[model samples]
Target chain A: MNEELKHYNDRAENLILNHLESGNVSKMIKDASIYSIQAGGKRFRPYLVFATLKSFGLDPAAGLSAAGAIEMIHTYSLIHDDLPAMDDDNYRRGQLTNHKVHGEAVAILAGDNLLTESFNVLAEDESLPADIRIQLVQVVSRAAGQSGMIGGQMLDIEAEGKNITMDELVMIHRHKTGKLIVAPIESAAIIAAADDETKALLLRFAEYLGILFQIRDDILDVEGDMSVTGKLSGSDARKEKVTYVSTYGLNGAKEQLELLKDDAEEILENLSSKLDTDELYSVLQMFAVREQ
Target chain B: MNEELKHYNDRAENLILNHLESGNVSKMIKDASIYSIQAGGKRFRPYLVFATLKSFGLDPAAGLSAAGAIEMIHTYSLIHDDLPAMDDDNYRRGQLTNHKVHGEAVAILAGDNLLTESFNVLAEDESLPADIRIQLVQVVSRAAGQSGMIGGQMLDIEAEGKNITMDELVMIHRHKTGKLIVAPIESAAIIAAADDETKALLLRFAEYLGILFQIRDDILDVEGDMSVTGKLSGSDARKEKVTYVSTYGLNGAKEQLELLKDDAEEILENLSSKLDTDELYSVLQMFAVREQ
Candidate 1:
């Protein structure tokens, strides 16, 4: 990864790990939560938070709490999703999944702990004003709650082994993955106190980025090496779950990714006159071509 | 239930049910969440919120959002606790548990949905000022998260079939059940803007009430009817899990309950000179001699 990306990644990791370590919770739960957290992911969502803030000429450090909170939410979702009752995966990120390491009950509780503590993290952030903190909580809860990520997950599970239409597939991914991806950028906007118009443009840019992220994910699932991707290739195909690749063939999915990249570029271009777009362009490039 | 108690119960029910029914989530999650919410419990925690607010001479309705949010957290914990990997119970409140009705995956998602949305409810509540709402989020999250209810639950699961000391048992119950029970009363104190001393005294009263509540629960498990309690009779003993009854003799447990009741009453008596303690007394009475 580039030095700038590594900086955001390290900051988010330190913030989350420090918070988890200092808590007075049960030792077992604390260990389980920290285990999955320290398991490596790219910290893509935190990058969006930092990059968006930098785009607005604000210090990226201002986005640290929001970045950490979003990453915690992301990590918790992965823990629950890997449970035997859910996706039943034994490996994630080339390591034993949470349930495989901890017992199922502990994994579930660890996920619960992370999810519950995320809101507390935002609420207790002394750097932000009370009102801004509340807004962050509101945005995050809505994105992760029934009408958002959970809702999408329910839809995905329901649609498994059945042929779903492209629109239906998009709807599911939009809810399941899109909302959370949008959350970090939107939170950055709120922190920057961007005007309504800038916020809307950033939101549109985020939507394209979310779809771009998923299409790239689907492509990676088909073409990625297990050593690099840290996932079982073609696992989605094995489950008979519909995806961008399934809906629009592999080549078609790649084509759709290109279109999304172009659209994202245009949105950033529109915002360039008002704000620095260098960091945002780097974020878009990472999303478009990330191998894992 | 008395007329006044019934009123608090009804208001809390309306607030929760209305909020659940009005969401734009997927049908499956919405149905599962509403199913658990509609399953009847005593609405005891909500009663604490309303009763505490009423004690301070504020409109009990002023406590509606906090009351609803706390109840949601309580219900989510119940749903998760009843999962097959956890207690594996098939019934709660005389109805099939969430997992039994909706399957394990949906039940897990539903529990997550309710938990995530709970913060949204408090954050979006315009009735309270922004700072107060933020405070509610912090308190509820802390009480429900790792250091509170979830932590207690982990300790309980860990202690199963093991010989544990009385202090260890107390510590587990304090984290698992005690923190959540204290949350509503502490929330009420915050809402009423009670003085620091008043808040500390009420916290002490809540601590006593939590132990009183657990002792009564242990007694109920030993000698209650399934029809009334909506749980299998003697299930605790059947599981061979330690409880107050198992540590102390049944008679000794009963003595402890009376002592706690008296202690709770004395705290109320002390507060009576400054505030209307009538509703609080009713709450204490309900905790003391309730049959179901």
Candidate 2:
């Protein structure tokens, strides 16, 4: 990414990181949330939101509410899925799972709070025009609900320990992980009041991004160093979980990522005249190939 | 409460319950949801929400979307709280805990989905004025968040396996159990487009009723019959959890509940002339004394 765009990404990440550290949230439930929300991952998705808003010539502030809300929702899911009852993993982003550190019940409720808490952040944003506020909330509620992330999670739970086909796997990951991935982009477009054309294109971009992102994680689950991934390599071994790498093999997964990235790039045809989100496309490419 | 009100409530409950039963939700999950949501408990809160909207001259159709949403939020929390991970609950509304039958992970996700899906239900109400739709969401979101339910859950979590003062216990229930209680009344007033004066009165009524509702649960936990409560007696003793009855003794708890109920009744004087929420008031009393 160019230096100017890098600055925007850095600034947005810092802003989110700072808010995550704010003292207002009680330490009673803060550590687990703080660990995951502030985990040193790239702010790639949230930045996409800001960039998408900027692309539509809206103030970056116009999208900050959804930006923070999306990130919190993302973080909440990660915490809960790591609990002993769900994915039952121990380490995440190289840190102990929330349940491990905070105890299972608190971890569960923390996730609940985080997900439920998103609306407060979004609604409290007075900067949003009234009409747009309704749209933003409606879109988000749908995405987070059964037809979106929760539905994906249900499919994921049922898909485990089975030899699933590629299509089944896609449905699992798209909902399990893809729905939240799409939220930032769609929310940004909603914030910007992007016309139908822009909304459709950005949605396509998000779909491609979700698959590419999930593929990259599956690949890492096989080869990433423990020091970096925190979780053990080969962790996917026992679940018989379906993934591009699992179904197509590692080399195949790599190729699939490339094809999906290409799809993402092509959709940028709608944004050819735009500048701000161009760098977001570049960032997605890097994310597709990043180390743990 | 009254012949007409009871008849209308039964009609509304059957409407929502029948539609929900026909849903393609997994049979096991569907049954689990019905166990609590359709249990013979009064549907007072949802009834009030619909009634409040009608009092302001809005169509009953406008209330249907939120009716299910609020009930789901209430049901999900009960399911999660009764789980081994949280309260280790075995009984709710005199029925087996969801986890007891559906398995913990499914139960957890079921609750999660219900909470997330509640928002989905609200957002999908395309017929409501966009502004009012957003307002309903904002109100419910605040009532359910950690600062509301999640926050209360946190406090309750912190107090567990410890000796907490009566004030602290009251605070916990106010959010833990009470905000969910507060949601129906506040949301009803909001949906009705009641003026500030009427809205304030409605809130006052909800707050008083909410605390009273909680104190009864506390009292029941101490001495309620398993036949009626659908669980082993001395419910609170097993957890050794602090409760209003535990702190104040049964008679004192009863006195406190009476005070709160009286306050709720006093607020009834200022209710708008068109709003006939007497049935709701009686339901509140029934909810508080159902253990008998």
Candidate 3:
């Protein structure tokens, strides 16, 4: 891992851990919330917030709250998505899923807590101007809410056992997975008070990175081994679920991933003069070719 | 309903309806979101927003978005609370629950959408100063998050079929249902930018109102007929749920309720010099005796 990226990840984990315990909520809820978030992932979303801030030459601390907020939103979505009534997955991050470990009701409430906590964390951040923090709330809410991730999840649910076109598939991933991926970058830019042009460039970078990440996920679902990925191989296909790989063959999906990677690199290159790109590019490279 | 209260309710319904439609999300998610919000209740949260604004002599329109936001949050909680994994309720507000009307997955997403949309609506509201809007988000998030309503729910869920002390029951109700009920009134005060003294008084009023409301709800659960309350009588008792009525006994609980009502009315009286109390008192009186 990039040392800077690793540092940010550690900071994010700490921020989230500390914030979860700062409240006087019941022990059970606080534990459930902590447990769910502690069930770790790649910390991709928070990394974006930090990397974006670094790119703007701002201290990564300025983006920590938003970073933690986005990650909380991501964790909450995953917790809910893995519910018995939703995906019913028994494992996540190579461990028993939230509902599988905590009873279904606890898991549901846990997700709700994380979601609600994300906003509270951001709203309470003293690092940013109150106005910017509010903007972060708005952006994060839109991305995490019905118009973005939740809406996509609904469509994904509705798409199950049904044939969906390529457009529908793109729409789902863009919302279900894409919006959250984009949120932290936007939030960081808002916090950094980056110029409109710079913010635009960051957004473009995030958009391509989001699609590329989903494409890689779909590809991995088909091509990777379960032992390496911690995910059941061919689960999407087994469920008869549509994906970029399902819509376009594995080869085509891989080809698209490469194209998006190039596009992202080009955007970063375009903004290389405006901000540091090495750390951002390194993080992007790490996510781009991960086995898991 | 009082004619003024009815006007605010209708306006709230319209704002929610329009906002849901304005989004470009899938028809399925949109419909699910709309269905839950349109399930039809007393719109008490939104009413509090308007009533608070009215008491401050501000145009009710100034409270519209915050009203809509609180209603959306309330609706989302209800949707999620009724899920099969949670309360497994099949009916809400005398109509089929969201999960029952839609699939469990859709219902979950719909609730999520409402929650996310609530922030968006508030963030996007042009009526209030940006700083006040941000304050609204902060206050609402805390009240709704793990420390407040969601945390309360965790306690409520854990308390089911178990013996609990009076203090524990009060804590559960205060967090589970009290925080949200208190949110709108606080939000309106923020919007009105009332003095610290006034805000403190409103918070006190809200605390009393919250306890009063939950006691009434518990009383209704025990004494209310389904035909009038749109809920099953003794359902809480049958579930072995701990409630004010169960913990205090009906007479004791009723006494407490009267005491809280008096406290609330007194606070309103104290604030009458700073803000009009007629509409506020009218609304409180209506809720005080509400059977449903």
Candidate 4:
């Protein structure tokens, strides 16, 4: 990660850890909830929240709660997705998956707790106005709920072991992965109170980044080592789940990644005339080529 | 149920059904979510929301979103609690539990969707001011999350098969069953914009009702028929789970229930001087004598 992006990531991490530590939950639940969070991923979603805030000439600190909230949502989704009934992965970020470390019952509750608390973090953020907090809840819930991430996940599960169309693939990723990516940026736009045009442009940029991020993930599953990726290589293939690489060849998937990167870059160029684009550009670069 | 209570219940049910039908989710998820919801449990929590609103002389419709939201949260908790890794019940409300009908994966996703959408319902309700909606979100999230419902669930699971004391049992029920019970009333108080004095009294009243409800449930498990309760009698004994009956004995638990009912009625008596308490009294009566 770039130095600036790393700084934002660390700040978001601190905010999340602090919030988790201060909650008056049961000891076991608190431990289980904190374990997966502290295991640490790229914090990519949070970085988008902070970067988008900076692009609007707003202090990134203004996006801290939102950044923390989105990361918690992301982490909770991962924990649930790794359940035995879902992906059944034993590892994440090179550590034991939540259920593997804690029992499945605790893992499920921890995920529930995290998902429930994400909205609280936003709703109780005294730093933001009540209207903004309400908007954050609205956007985040819509993105996380059935019509968004969860809906996409259902589609993906139904499509497993089948040859799905490219459009279907896009639709699945758009909701499953795209909504969350879009939500953080959209949340930052709400926090910054950006105009419709800028918000639309940012959303468009996030959509491209979402596709780009997924394609790169497919590519990594094929080419990257488990040591670096922190996920078992070729697990998607083993599960027979369709992906960008499965639908398009590896080379074709890489080509698609390039096109999405270009599209996102163009949006950043257009946005540059109005706001700082350097941090966003770094995020785009990270998405385009992140090894993990 | 009383005629007036039934009217409020039907209104809350319509709001929930309409909201569920209108969501843009996948077909399978929609079916799974709607199936459990449509299975028809008494809308008791929603009644508290509506009744509390009525107690403050607010239109019951004003609490519609909050009523629906709390019921959705309550429903989600029940679905998750019935999962194989948890209580593993095959039936709820005289029908197949969510996991028994839909696969575990879909059941889990359905519960998640419900929980997520519960907040959306509150946040997007145009009738309430943003500040009130924000407060609703904060209170509901706190009540549903780790420090409240989920936290208490953890304690209950930990206490299973153990000969727990009265204090420990109260602590567990206070969190597990109590918080959610209080949240709806608290949400209604926020919606009605009740003064601190009234709100505190309502909260206290709700706390007593929560314990009373749990005690009655325990008594019913031992004395009521499955035909009436829609649950297998002695299932709690089979699991060796601690309950009010297990701790206080049947007669002792009934005595405790009466005490709580009296305490709650006393609060209502105090509140009656300022506002209507008829609907609230009905709720308390139902809790005290409910066969199911």
Q: Please compute the TM-score of chain B alone for each predicted structure, in the order given.
A: 0.96, 0.84, 0.96, 0.95
Query: In order, what lDDT does every prediction score?
Result: 0.89, 0.72, 0.86, 0.89
Tens digits of per-residue lDDT for model 4 on A109-203? 99999999899899989999999999999999999988899989988888877788888988999999999999999999999888899989999
What CAPRI grade goes to candidate 3?
Answer: medium
Which DockQ value does candidate 1 get?
Answer: 0.85
Task: Put the candidates in TM-score order, highest first.
Answer: 1, 4, 3, 2
Residues B1-292 of candidate 4: C-alpha lDDT, one tens digit per residue? 6676568778877877787777674778888888888888888888888888888888888888888899999999999999998988898877889999999999999999899999999999998999999999999999998889999999888887778888888899999989999998999999888889999999999999998888998999999988889877887788787888887799999998888888898999999988899889988998899998
**TM-score to true structure, per model:** 0.97, 0.88, 0.96, 0.97
What TM-score against the true chain A does chain A of each candidate get?
0.97, 0.87, 0.96, 0.95
Off by over 4 Å in 2: A1-27, A30-32, A222-231, A237-240, A273-277, B1-40, B54-61, B221-225, B237-242, B272-277, B284-289
The 10-residue segment of model 4 chain B with minimum total lDDT is: B1-10
Residue-level lDDT tens digits of model 1 in B88-151:
9998876899999999999999999889989999999988898999999999999999889998
Residue A23 in model 2: lDDT: 24
Q: For candidate 2, give the docking quality class from DockQ.
A: acceptable
Candidate 2 lDDT at B55 equals 55
Better of 1 and 3 by DockQ: 1
lDDT (C-alpha) at residue A250 in model 2: 94
